[model samples]
Target chain A: MERKWNKSSLMGWQFVALPSALILLFSFYPMFQSLLLSFQSGKGTVYHYVGIDNYIRLFSDPMFKQAVFNTLLYLIVQVPIMLLLGLVIAHLLNNPKLRFKGFYRTAIFLPCVTSLVSYAVLFKSIFAVDGILNKMLLSMHVIQEPIAWLMDPIWARVVIIAAITWRWTGYNMIFYLSAMQNIDPSIYEAASIDGASKTRQFFSITVPMLKPIILFTAIISTNGTLQLFDEVVNITKGGPGNATMTISQYIYNLSFVYTPNFGYAATVSYAIVVMVAVLALFQLKLGGEKR
Target chain B: MKKLTTMVVHLFLIVASVISLFPFVWMLMGMTNSSSEILKGKFSFGSMLMENIHKLLDMTSLGAAFWNSAIIAIIGTVGTLLLSSMAGYGFEIYHSKSKSRLFGLLMLSMMMPFAAVMIPLFRMFSGMGLLNTPTAVILPTITTAFMIFFFLQNTKSFPRELLQAGRVDGLSEWRLFTRIYMPTMKPTYAAAAIITFMNYWNSFLWPLIALQTQDKKTLPLVVSSLASSYNPDYGIIMVAIVITTLPSVLIFFLLQKQFVQGMLGSVK
Candidate 1:
């Protein structure tokens, strides 16, 4: 059966043209609009074309600097820890002989599905000055006093990082677990017959095989952490001193929390864009070659 | 020694699951306790579920907000599935050098953090008098490039011979899509639906900025407001959280089969 390539047939122009145009409008237009918005400066009703003042001001703004620091802190500390834990857990669970694997998988994966409000509320309670964590620590004689996890600046950041890692590690695990399923079990059997220990086989075979997925999750997780807002806003409110403030939260505050500085807020938003683009380019260059 | 190691791993997993499941258990326990009791770390179940429910029902427009969320999620998911899958299918099926270049550009959009776009998005929505509508919340995300990219990646596994056969069958372009493409991609559609529904359902920032009134607020926004009260009642807030989370969990469980399979297909 010969497939016709006619105007009205399955390979027609309208088929591709409509979807392509939709992408151009919905995906491209708002982005271009944002690019334009970043260049202008104004209050609610007043407006002016400030060529690069907003971008220039970002370098000097103390709060913006703090937010940049906090975001990067999370990127460095939280991303590696979560990915590593996820990798370990996925390796353990990939054992076909492992007991109650389904239960373990669901239990970890369950956290990601928990509603943001529910988990945020739960985390706030668990990390409160007199919350379960402190209670447990005192009961176990780990500490004689209750720690102000959310009130102290350094501790507050710790709690935020811990909360993010806890919530997302399972999500990353799902990616790894799914990727692991594609591996032939015979390979593991082969390794065992050749006298490779479990840990050795994991490091040698599993890590290298799952490198693409690891990189993919790393990029996605980086994007997620870079846009970190809901957790900070709900859990910390960027507060006690701006210890846990993120760029997204700062952008939110600029746009809605304070007197609305739409133009300036757009500029801060673009800073994140530039950072993500550079980091993504670097990661792709670093990881893409190996794949 | 082998038994000891296995025992340790099992113990570790058991402890981890308990820790993981503690909050959910607490949420339920909190729903059953009073505000003061919850704040005081009362871990056991109480008899206040009905009271908490009553208080939450009276404090907010629970029915309207839930309805609004449902409508938005349902519509947004449907729109996302159709438009994104169309683009995804187009990009994968009609693969060309230019289309591939365009695909790379679309992937770049996925990397741009939403924080970078929120304010400009707000201004754009406000300019169109869309600040307080479901349309405002759903329109911008309806054709998200991330969703498009996801579908495109999954479409890589879609058999080309099926399309060739459909063409041989003298089916029109639309018929090939509606007849051949749609049915074969049920797993993909299911996964996309679950993800998009949750995205639209639990979406907080955009809806918070866009929707101004009490009636238009989503479950998350309403819960946020509830939790923010100067003297927030933990029991009541827990109830709100449970309500907000239930639908997504239920949707995920309902669609888990396809969700995992679709994702597996994409990675391979």
Candidate 2:
């Protein structure tokens, strides 16, 4: 029995060993190396230990600050809007009386199929100075002139936000829709029978019932927004004076686009890690405490 | 008044659906229109489809990019599913206190942003003389913690009785895993495959950095350059985008149930 137990345990290690090793090498090891790299200031291989310097630079760095501010603006503004839109859509679709549910669901969920870059490019062209959107708006007489959407800082950010919202709203909706399915309809039925309005039922029941999923979507959206790279890079190019530049794009620019500043890029990368850690912790707290 | 409200609701939904699907429609139309014609808001399909395809093929390594993307996505998805399922199974089926702790640790890595690890990963891959290879992209992500977690979560409902039953039949542990466990987890594997495949297909940041040369770049990377170019041809770019997007979209539609199941698998 002792030998058999030992053999089984060994088999367990055999299964897990390679994958764990790969994770340790690829994920954990690079993470540790990045931490070490963060401390040393250098362009490329030539480097020296500059303890606390990169961390200090982060506080006053304008580009860093702008990136952080833009990312948070997206987080604060876009996440709530997208999630709310998703919830509303999901709720609407959850209605038994709604016609053509399949068509609506599929049509609305279609945007998520586009690759991030493809969508960004699409949005970019549509919002271009003389692009389709401008032409449409012109025909509608909404604006006398083309908006120069991606060329302006503010409109560029809006376009970025709109692009992201377009891509992910369906994704979040699917989650809410699935979670809504698990909800017993009798609760909503009871509420309605007791003279509750649809709005009140949605707020009191659907929202509350989908709290965990809401929290889950929030965490992922927050995480995705924090590490936002593809859209910002493709749509705006973090340009019109870096208004839509995310920290990830900033890090990419630092390490690769500009003269490769490995150490400082690593430092900039830490800011995202810290933000993700904080937001994730705060969300977990928010979710757990409410539950 | 109730009828009016219902009309308003339907109108809102119709508007939203149109807004959502307009880009896909425009993209398809752009294939048949010239760059200027597209910018001028030509809603109808023009005669530029063959021209766009020819120009895209002629001007870029579109074929090689597609081939590379396919190879990477297929291999990466297979590897991710197999290895992650193995670890998930090992940790679940052969439960131990240490394995649990290790898994918890692995989960922590999931929260570590790719930006943080990317520089080092690039350096690590470069050092190993594997920077330009598909191996670099696949290796780091091959055994992701989230995939492992997904597999572990799905594996909970797996029948342990089957494993015990297999053991009694005198099959070796490896044989039991390959023959029995894998066969039973087909749905979970299918779900994971679609998600992993899409991820690999659409992956950009890492591939943008890793695959430097024209010949080795993925479709997304190629499309990115086309879009970013000074004299961008919207017709050709649209064709390239369609090609890059078609496989995943097809996969999503074909195995859509599994894709949704896979996505929700993580949330659960």
Per residue, candidate 1 scores C-alpha lDDT tens digits across A1-291 of 233333233343444456556556655666677777778877876778899888899999999999999999999999999999899888888778889989998888778777666577678877867766787788899999998888899998898898888788888888898889898989988999999998899988999899999998888888888999888878878887999999999998988889888888888888888888888888888897876
True interface contacts reproduced, per candidate: 0.45, 0.73
Name the weakest run of 10 consecutive residues (lDDT summed) in model 2 chain A: A2-11
Superposition error at A24 for model 2 (Å): 1.0
Error of 2 at A118 (Å): 0.7
Q: Please report how far candidate 2 places residue A100 from its true position, in Å.
A: 0.5
**Candidate 1: residue A56 Cα off by (Å):** 1.9
The collision pairs in model 2 are none
Model number with the top DockQ: 2
lDDT of 1 at B256: 73
Chain A TM-score values, per prediction: 0.93, 0.96
Per-prediction DockQ scores? 0.53, 0.79
TM-score of 2: 0.98
Residue-wise C-alpha lDDT for candidate 2, range A209-251, written one tens digit per residue: 8999999899989999999999988887899898999999999
Give the range where candidate 1 chain A is weakest over 10 consecutive residues by summed lDDT: A1-10
Model 2's lDDT to the true fold?
A: 0.91
